[model samples]
Target: MDDTDTHLLRLLQHNADTSHAELGRQVGLSATGVHKRLRRLREDGVIKRTAIVLDRAKLGLDLMCFLKVNFKNNLASPNLDELHGAVSALPEVLECYTLTGTNDAIVKVAVRDHVALREFLQRFSEAQSIIERVETCIVLEEIREGNDYAVPKPQ
Candidate 1:
């Protein structure tokens, strides 16, 4: 992508609600040109689906914990797809990943309280055969946030 594309991404990241006209002005392109560029970006898979990020506390997810899990056997020995499906189905599991080394999967779990988290942990430990052990750390605060692009400084 060119500098124009990077600028576009930054604008969208800051506020996806930006209008096509405003984007054209900011990116030094006409409205039609901006539209065509956006279409090309989408077709090339550069732009994913636009979504709204909700506040976890406001959404009733008061607790957030990061979990590391180890598998009983080789990476592919257990059904990875099935494990992913099962974990994704749980409302509390926000994110899960397959990794290298001692651990198999890392998960982000969100719940209401310590009691509820412990209950979910017990259930998860009992049901999944591939999961050998799990270690969790609670999120105390957000240190850095994600940004889709970087804004240029004034000359």
Candidate 2:
């Protein structure tokens, strides 16, 4: 909303565990003021939800891949809801997005290994009958992965 609010959000983005007092100290607000502002931000939908970021490799999920999917049926005639539901039901799929190119959708997936990846792909193929082709690119290294977004400055 204001400069102080923007600053608070930036601090929280870096570390959601920041105490109200610490946030207040950095933003020059009282502890109660900081708490109230944070509550207001949450109520106003400025802050969606807080979550913990995990290390995929540490969790034994060593494979990360991007899948480009194309449909056999005419794009205008396909059952979009059923297709979306099928993709959403897969646990290995981390994210999926609609595209404007030759492919219909791009999906980010994570699995334990190549064997698991094959099984996941097999299930993916079975999930939708309209699938024409799927191209996969495995990630060798992830330099950065985060949900951070640029916070606009108050005018």
Candidate 3:
């Protein structure tokens, strides 16, 4: 992708609701041109999907925590698929990523309160026997949370 495509992505990242005309105006492209570019980006999978960002606090999700999961290496064949499936089945788990360090995976979770968190953890631990240890850290304050990535500034 060129500079123009990158600029369009940056604009959309800020506000997916921005009209094609408005995007065209800012990027110096015609409305149709903007549409074609966006379509191409989507087809190529650069623009995966668009959805609204919600306020966790407003939704009564007052607790945000991270879980560091370590697996038992002694297992001849770890049931990684089962662990992943369990994680995916839980709505409270916002995100999960495979790690390269001591932990096997890191999970981001959000819940209403401590009781809910404890329940979620209990279920999670029980769901997978391969889990050796799960360490949790409650977020005191979220400075920033977003999917935005750095794009080159428009000239």
- TM-score of model 3 vs. true structure: 0.93
Best by lDDT: 3
Candidate 1 backbone collisions, by pair: none
lDDT of 3 at 93: 95
Q: Which of 1 and 2 is ahead in lDDT?
A: 2
TM for every model, in the order presented, reads: 0.86, 0.91, 0.93
lDDT, candidate 2, equals 0.89
The digit string of per-residue lDDT tens for model 2 on 1-155 reads: 99999999999999999999999999999999999999999999999999988889899999999999887763645646656888789989899877787888888999999999999999988998887889999998898887777899988
Report the C-alpha lDDT of model 1 over 46-137, residue by residue, as the tens digit.
88778877788898788899888877774774558657766866888878888887778888888999998998898777667777788988
Q: Assess the local accuracy of residue 155 in candidate 2 as a C-alpha lDDT between 0 and 100.
A: 88
Model 2, residue 94: distance off in Å is 1.0
Q: Give the poorly placed runs of model 3, Cα more than 4 Å off.
A: 74-77, 152-155
Candidate topping TM-score? 3
**Candidate 2 vs. true structure, TM-score:** 0.91
Across residues 41-104, which tens digit of lDDT does each residue of candidate 3 receive? 9999989999999989999999999999888862234557867788989999999987787888
lDDT of 2 at 122: 93
